[model samples]
Target chain A: MSFSIDQILRGDIPRVERPPAADPSLVPVRLRVNGQDHDLQLEPRVSLLDALREFIGLTGTKKGCNQGACGACTVLVEGERVNSCLTFAIMHQGKDITTIEGLGTPDALHPLQAAFIEHDGYQCGYCTPGQICSAVAMLKEVEHGDASHVTSDLMATDVQLTDEEIRERMSGNVCRCGAYLGIVDSIRAVYEQQKGQ
Target chain B: MRAFTYTQATDASAALHAALQNPEAKYIGGGTNLVDLMREEVERPNEVIDINALPFSQIEVLPDGGVRLGALARNSHTANHPLVRQRYPVLAQAMLSAASPQLRNLATNAGNLLQRTRCYYFYDTTAPCNKRQPGSGCAAIHGVNRIHAILGTSEQCIATHPSDMAVALAALEAVVQVQGANGTRRIAMEEFHRLPGDHPEQDTTLGRDELITSIDLPALPSTANSLYFKVRERPSFAFALVSVAAVLELEGEQIKNVRLALGGVAHKPWRARTAEEALLGKPATAENFRQAAEAELQTAIAYEHNAFKIELAKRTIVRALLTLAERQLLA
Candidate 1:
């Protein structure tokens, strides 16, 4: 707890700059993408959403607010959805990440993706990917018995998602195209399919 | 924002050591609150100590029939935890009623409690806010008094803590576990937040080097029934204008016990302790609840824009109490 001013002022420490953090061409950063290992070099302040789209070549995620206000930049990090835009690219090192591109493709669509296509869940398709990803995660959340604002019985042990549940759970995502009717229908369709309806 | 050095703490002790070494460092968990503050230029730390990966992510059952919540535990995970849902239903409700699914998933338990006020002036750097810049003067005092405090207001600051979960914890007598250079200490939930007084810049009584490790909540009586009610302009995902968390233990048709706490109207969650004194051993009637609600709000001094919160909170408390009283009959 004590230090001598004379010794501190001596300051015989070496100012050695050892090695570089990343390659000169690209900044080194680690990210777990689609259950796979991803190490990339990018700018220090790049957003997770933008880094995913530009550097990782995954464009399924859309950019709406760039801020945390909208859910357009939502993605699953360790099975939980978060706004990628609000997060830094470097923060997600070694964490399991699942994006909409990882959900499915045109050849083999995820259930939520297929449900959206079948239910005509989108118009102009701006918010569709984000909506599909959110629904996919939401169904899993409900299946795990997570409660929502409208989930009446917190004590039920087995929570059932009513329409109100779906609405409240998905309030973060805004469909500026007024495509919410179809979006809700698509989520309902997927829910019914998962329920064996 | 200028690039700051990144430091990741391997464990709790390491985190404490790092924090002690760098007094200008701030802990980063989920980056939900810190990132926005950085974006708004409200806070610019010289170093960010990433404590999200610390091994304190588990929610454990204390030996005394209580719960020990990890600091890094996200809001959604804690809200959905089995013990939280069963034993602390009000906490679950309050957590679920916070930000949307995405935000709740990323928001950590410690970050949520340590979050700064959402006052417009604090975020807008140009506006004068004593909390944001000490002695700058509070523009929010008269500029836009809406969404400000009523219970613990001072001329220097009028901001409110924006966590419904904190409100529930305040009512339940939660204890905050923090680690500092001198070691670990427990802070009572009620005292975790400081009232706006002569020093508006000091948000918490904690020293700059202290870091929250976890929050431990003592077990309430299992027979107690609780509920949370938030009055908002819109239905879902809006901040509470006035929220009430009430717990009632009824004996037959009469109220044997009552515990009340209110949010969105104070610097911290306002515990209706004085009001609860009046409701104990009273009949389970709307009149009793109305009286109790009025008794609690008697001390509230509201501003021009937020004066409506006084009435809205009264109605919220009454309805919350009556609703629980009715549910007690069925249980």
Candidate 2:
């Protein structure tokens, strides 16, 4: 279900040849998901979350709202976390994608995964994957000195990762089970460990 | 969702050509809004043109002491860009106060400017919404419309523009660079988005076949004391209930210059030109700020559930201006 640039453009190598009006409903999309490339023939309207969960057989990413309102479908695309439900599968051509499945294994867990378990970060576990993925990116953002909405001084070059900052940054992923305290503790543990390392 | 054809365009002209080829085709940059609408069946495009690869992601410094921002630049990137953060802190704060970080990372400058309203009726296809389908009666007129517009609304629609960035742009007087079938032209941000007078279906002044290539911001050095204050139902990931973007310049005690624009109140960004005019040479005091807010909101017409917005908008404006004035004192 994958097509080269030529097959997509429907002509010679360089010039783009518009495909005829035959079977334009489905497009051949190639996705690199969780360190694996998957060739999926999908409808143009299929979301990236659907392509990952249904097409690629990866169900780690949860679909809470199926809209961008909730961060349940968060996934790292090209090292940046984005809402998978809000983007088309065909848009991500050759980008690096990392899902919750790629985060850790049963025997060996990522620090965030271990901290979540220790801190009891999940009561229902529906938003754990998105929470972990978003926390991973949030750490990188803090390391890069990216300020959050709660950051008082916009001109400050250095931003310390406070509890308020973590809460504000992780506000996208809503845990309906009221496990916010546990989630905050888990993220803080990981941040502290990263700084120590 | 309905099936559609998809194609990727590497340049701006190619994307415009594809859009011209199919009248029902839509150019998708981040797809944060359009993709959701397509899933809800509110928007059914026969073709979707991918324009993410266009070289419109750079933040350029114009020779005439201005900034030119490419259309494809992500919201997070633009908000955090050194030039924007330093020169236009209000714009940065506005963008930061918008949707979640993940969305801001994916939403582009042009897409943010062109995002549709988040009215529940507008998103619910089963409900009657003239913005979603022209000639369809507006359900928000009598339905649960706590989030409906209170200013610049017509009988046809009460939907408000949902972009926090647009409010700041309107206050800063940014210009939109559009490339259409005819040619390239620049549209002032003030005149770029139109009010829902008779036709609520048409959102912005962007033509059906036009592509927004970039946005140009004229230098406002006095806007160093600018800020964006947003009040939402929740702290994050929610649209503004009443947001204000204010820029203040003070000479000793009197106000030298001021700019004000409001969100969640109208079909477009409600620029407080009257407020700015009233506070031009007035003293930088809370009383003057309140008077300016009242002067700008004189023509406001609020619906049943949204009458509180008039008072809320006025308080937010005064608060924003007073905060900026206090910052000037501290500086």
- Please give me the DockQ of candidate 1 compared with the native complex: 0.28
Q: Write the per-residue lDDT of candidate 1 for residues B23-65, one digit (tens) a residue.
A: 7777888888887676556887767788877887899999999
Grade the docking of candidate 1: acceptable
Each candidate's lDDT (Cα)? 0.83, 0.88
Instruction: Tell me which residue pairs clash in candidate 2.
Output: none
- Which stretches in model 1 have alpha-carbon errors above 4 Å? A1-27
Find the 10 residues in a row with the least total lDDT in model 1 chain A: A11-20
Alpha-carbon deviation at A190 in model 2, angstroms: 0.8
In the range B1-331, model 2's lDDT, one tens digit per residue, is 6678788898878888898888888889999999888777788888899998889999989998999999999998899888888889889999999999999999999999999998877876667888888998998898777888988889999999999999999999999999887899999998999899889999888898788999999988753579999999888878999999988899888898788999999999999999999998889999988998999899988787889999999999999988988989888
Estimate the TM-score of every prediction. Answer: 0.92, 0.94
Runs in model 2 deviating more than 4 A are: A1-25
